[model samples]
Target: MTKPANTQLTDARRGDARADRTTFLWTAAFIFAGMTVTILSAATELQRANSAFPVGKVVLYEITGFLSFLAMFPLIAWLVTRSTPGQHSWRQVIPVHLAASLGVVILHVSLFVLLRKALVPVFFGEPYFFTDNLARDFIYEYRKSVLAYGIVLFAITFGRELEQKRRELAAAREDAKKSHRLTLKCGGRSIFVDASDVIWAKSASNYVEVKTPGAEHLARATLASIERQLGDAGANAVRVHRSWIVNADYISRIEPTGEGDLKIEMKDGATVPGSRRYRGNLNLS
Candidate 1:
């Protein structure tokens, strides 16, 4: 079943927080693995060129990739928080994400280029040259930047969705624990009932009359209040009038009143007056 709107918001918030934590933990790993691979490649190329101390070149590339990724990760995380992977809304999410993608690419490329120009010579013992072509460097780096951003998107969205699923599973388990029984405190006493056995309830001035096929129990609460409590417990009972409620499971007949109201007949020959205002809530057969 679909979650309630407020519940969905609460879950989404919890998921977002979880994603943030996941992102932080994973980002460190991401930077480390990324640094290792890129540095290894740089070492291999410099060694092939017979350059001494290829370690400096390796350090330069490692720092560049790491810094660029760091700059863009938060933006990607924010984007994924609002709209996870495969989930979009009517709020122009696509356009906003597109803009974010461009921003990530641009930030990564710009920062990398600036750091390369400044630090390559002092550290790597070589001049930083993009084959003497700025445009070519930008284009080449843009390709990798886009790829990196895509990976970040996948990571952040996947993490949030996984966390969301885990929370929902946990909630389901908790609900299961409480499924068979519910306790109501009223009249200075505690009354326990089998959730499934509850057939209907009605307003009784300052108290509520809860009925099962076997017996009736009175609780010191308003009908409106109990209806909300029952609804929260996933009860099938619904308010049929200002003063009455009926259980969907016990409904056997719906007799339409000429005044556009309804007379809900129960399986036990009991009836409740259903107002026209509440008729829309009924799923009469």
Candidate 2:
């Protein structure tokens, strides 16, 4: 019994460890991709100043960029994961990008002596000291380019993503509004109804019987206008039958009950039939 229990516990622990690894990889990839774009933008800007394209200078810049990208990994990971809002919102990405850009420049400055020394052998047959003339201009230009381009790249990429998220949020809010429940009281009577909550409504000349939640309501509203309102909310408030508008959120279990009958079990313990014509609406939602 103890051996079996230990085996099960070990398996569960391994599963949890794997999940953590996956999460870390995803976070790291997002950070790395952003940094790559920033670095590449800097390279593009340097390329545009093509008149001063020094082979030695470009080679030296490549080495510095490689090292900066490597150092930026841990810096970005720390900034994004350490903050509370960073873990949940896009706000974390802004700080991470700033830190990454700063880290690249700072690391270049701190390791200038060593980087220059290493590049001497790569660009020239013989190794040279950091005090050489070749190291001076290359280091100066490299630092200037990294700062200017890194910010540009981060702003463009991050701004695009932020705008995309904002649009998605706006669309979701519009959808929620269409299906949202509203409560109103008039003449000592309280009424609560959602546009999508109405399963069916019938015209009684001047009054309408609105079927919703778990009861029927007599409200003074036009069915045509209500249908148009649901459309503004989202595709979820689609009309199944001419008289019925069902809330897709309440649908829990859907199954075929017979040759031509389909049963939908709702979260509120209500049963609604899914007709052949309405099956297309279910797919839309």
Candidate 3:
């Protein structure tokens, strides 16, 4: 018995989110540490200018400095997904990438804030946007350095996340190859169904209807477990609605009607749904 690809992805996401929390936490910690270092360095620089600026003041500056970057996390993640990861893993990649990228952005911003302060000690550059300090001068100068730093961080973050996605994709392919094969008897005839042959599967109480190129076969199983077993066979075996799995391969056309309901026509002329809730995964712009 095999599950649909989308279901497996959903399960994978849930499992990965749960299990990979440690990885996420570690990544966050690493970024946070980077930010702390930057803030400390900035404080040291600021201290050179105004020795009266307390250590506690530096901490406060670092905390507030990271605010803009932390707020932009969601936007950055969405941009990355639409720009890169979406193509390889479908929309499933969005949530995982978002979760990971959010952590990264927070880290990036924290570091930026820390470093923003430390510029003076590290590079002897000016710190403020609109004031000539006792040390260095000019608001315009601050703009140039901030922009340069932001560009560099953005590039690095994009590249790092893209690399992570590439690795994840390879792992998914390998997992799919290992788990997506099946042999069954349909109408007294033996048929071998490759993962790709399946357009989707439907559940009928105890038995699941495995729809393939030739015909649909009734297998006694649960769709939930079958979905997991399918692994990365293909995410197109999407859960169009709760009861049906639509194979992405067979999705010939989609038509939008009123009230957020969609009419989808498959290659087999079998019509399914385009419910607003799950449609985002089906055809994402």
Candidate 4:
């Protein structure tokens, strides 16, 4: 039974949504793991140096910083998707990314400072100050933020490319599976013919005359177009002339004409003309 067009479309949308959710979760996991390791390393270094900052306070500061960066990830992902690397010229992509990175740096620093100011005094007795010099702190944070932007951009870009490749491979496999069946549309009617059942085909004006064991179909398609539709089955179905394509599996005999052309007889008792120009393309064992 054939499925309704709306149901097929809905299923496709659901599949896309599931794939997107999976990609998002994987990306978040990688970012979280990296931030966790960084936080641990920072705490360890501070303890080893005997810094006056409490270890718990340091951990809290790092957590807030990580959250700020995480919050910026959606914006970064949007920018990357809008101006993909290979899709756009470097001149165009570079300026967009640069501007976005600056915006991200400013937003990230502001968020991180706000989170610290709001949480630090509640945890500890003293209020938190990001730095003594505002200008210097902003510049320092910008340097690190830009690096983070680059990393996030690369991750999203690579993930999209990988997903695209996976989809292409999957589509190719599905096409291969469907190649064994040809759908022929005539007027308001549709016919499905197995590739192996096809004995021969010939060009008829704009249409292709496809012959099967006990049926003939005049599909509104060109010979070349119908030939491509055969896909993997094309190996057995060869173009013996400009207007003719014959199935070697159904060929009973190939007789050469005195005029350098050939007469190919099918097991279905049909005959197709073969041009010597395309004779090399046909091989019968």
Query: Which is the leading candidate under lDDT?
Result: 4
Deviating ranges (above 4 Å) for candidate 4: 1-23, 181-285
- Local accuracy of candidate 1 as per-residue lDDT tens digits, 206-280: 888888778888887667656655665677877889898877888888998878899888887788899998887
RMSD of each: 15.7, 14.6, 17.1, 12.1
Q: Which of the two, 2 or 4, has more TM-score?
A: 4
lDDT by candidate, in order shown: 0.74, 0.54, 0.58, 0.79
User: Roughly what TM-score does model 2 have, to 2 decimal places?
Assistant: 0.32
Per-residue accuracy of model 4 over 1-285 as CA lDDT, tens digit each: 445999866755555445555666776687679778987888889979998878788678778888898888778877876787887899999999999999999999999999999998999978988898999989998998798788778777777665654554444334535666676667746677788788888999988899988889998767875676665544378999999998888888999996769999989888889998998887744
* Candidate 3 lDDT by residue in tens digits, 96-159: 5545554554455545556556654444345633234622432333443345334433553445
lDDT of 4 at 209: 94
Q: Candidate 1: TM-score?
A: 0.53
- Clashing residue pairs, candidate 4? none
lDDT of 4: 0.79
TM-score of each: 0.53, 0.32, 0.35, 0.57
Q: How would you encode candidate 2's per-residue C-alpha lDDT over 1-285 as one tens digit per residue?
A: 124988866754454344434444554465557556665766687778774545556546555655544444444334433432323555765565555656555565556557766776777666745445656756675577456435434333343344444443444345446556433222336465665666554444545566666787775545544555455544356455545556676667778767655677767676666666667777633
Candidate 3 structure, TM-score to reference:
0.35
Query: Which parts of model 3 are misplaced by more than 4 Å?
Result: 1-179, 183-192
